[model samples]
Target: MAESEAILAAWDAYSDRHSDADGWPLDEVAYGWRMVQRDSETWRAFLPVRPGARQLLATAAFQLQHLSAGDIAPHWPSHLRDLNQALDRLEELRRGHAEVREARRTSGPVSQEKFIDSVAERNEEAWGYLDTWAAKGHVLLDVHAAAYKAPVRWVPTPAPTTVPARRAGRHV
Candidate 1:
């Protein structure tokens, strides 16, 4: 099997083995957020210096928001507003980055240094939003665990035989 398939299989087995008293499948939700948290941390190591890091972080944030709007919302209504706010900030950051890229492309080599400086400035701003997003995610995870009496700690699964290819220019 492909590595993703193997990972999914393992995740499925793990989820099957762990559920709340009401059969709410709390472990799957908590585990998904945990993975997102791990990836967010990994992304952070290089994100403050690399504007290219925005996409991965944005994707994770959006996914988490989607989860909150769906299955997780009913249980944690209070956190939904915070998650939405974080996602809105992230979207604003993304748009700001896009404008910088567009300006750089049109202005040509004469403004290369300026472009770099702009990216650096935006990177710091991006980090603030990402940090808050991750923090909110952690809070939601904690609330989920506490409400359902689910374990917050992740149980290790066997490694996939073949790792997936990393995206070009991405740290995580």
Candidate 2:
């Protein structure tokens, strides 16, 4: 099956299992994963430009941190640590890109080519970190869905229907 189909199937299974209890936010998780997949494909086509790539990286970091702060962290400390490491590397790449941009701005048009050349390496490094983070996130989501469980609340019983007595046993 295609990757997206597999992901959808897994989500369906997880939702079925956790139908009674609150768990991960499905919309947020799905959106984040979609962004990661799109970014990876774009990276393969060509180096992602700075603004869009930064946004994607920031989104990934936020999602990772959200997962880490939730019930998943305790159950998967190693995966959480890997995500944190990836975040650090991504941040470093961001700083490097910013510095290059600043240098280019101050150097005027003459050095534009030089700056672009320098940024290519940093962009590639950013893509590498992002790819690793995406893979780790997939594993984290799968494991969390498989193992994590929130507090179970029993389904409330329905109230009894109040039926009026037949009118003095009169026939309908």
Candidate 3:
């Protein structure tokens, strides 16, 4: 199976195994796991250039799934919409910053610009929405913890060839 499929399978297995630990029924845990995995996949796919916005989405996803499973009714769609708008703005700002950066890099001694400031503003707005949504329900991440961990994989290395020997017990 592919790596994503394997990861998902593992996650499913883990959730099933741990379903009893939670105070909910088996179906609730399964549903929550699926929701978390779906959002995780979405954020993993779209990781924006915005600094904290991506993390905000990740934390929101986890918290929403957890809350939903725990019988909490949250306005997840409205929250997601707010974050989505902020992400769009951040993306625009990020593109502008990149263009400015490239222009300065190609040219020489360009005047200082508000690239960092633009990024800060966009990122701050996105984070603000995230914070607001978290206040209404739950925040999966702590102040110091990052909301997401980018997916990574290991590749196998080729084995070295051995020299030929005339006999197993005796050398030529």
Please tell me which predicted candidate would have the highest lDDT against the true structure. Answer: 2
Top TM-score prediction, candidate number: 2
Give lDDT for model 1: 0.52
Write out the backbone clash pairs for model 3. Answer: none
| Candidate 3: tens digits of C-alpha lDDT, residues 72-140 | 324554656565665666466557667777877897756564654444444444433333433422222
lDDT of each: 0.52, 0.54, 0.49
Candidate 2, overall lDDT?
Answer: 0.54
* Cα RMSD, model 1: 22.9
Ranking by lDDT: 2, 1, 3
The root-mean-square deviation over C-alpha atoms between each candidate and the true structure, in angstroms, is: 22.9, 17.9, 19.9
Please write out the lDDT profile of model 2 over residues 66-170, one tens digit for every residue.
443444445355655675676578677768878878867786664766765565566556655555554555554554453444443367999879877798869
Error in Å for residue 141 of model 1: 4.5
lDDT of 1 by residue, 1-172 (tens): 1332333355457556666656666767686554444434433443352453345335444444544333444534444456556556766766887888886678665376777556555554655555454444454444444435533346699999999998999895
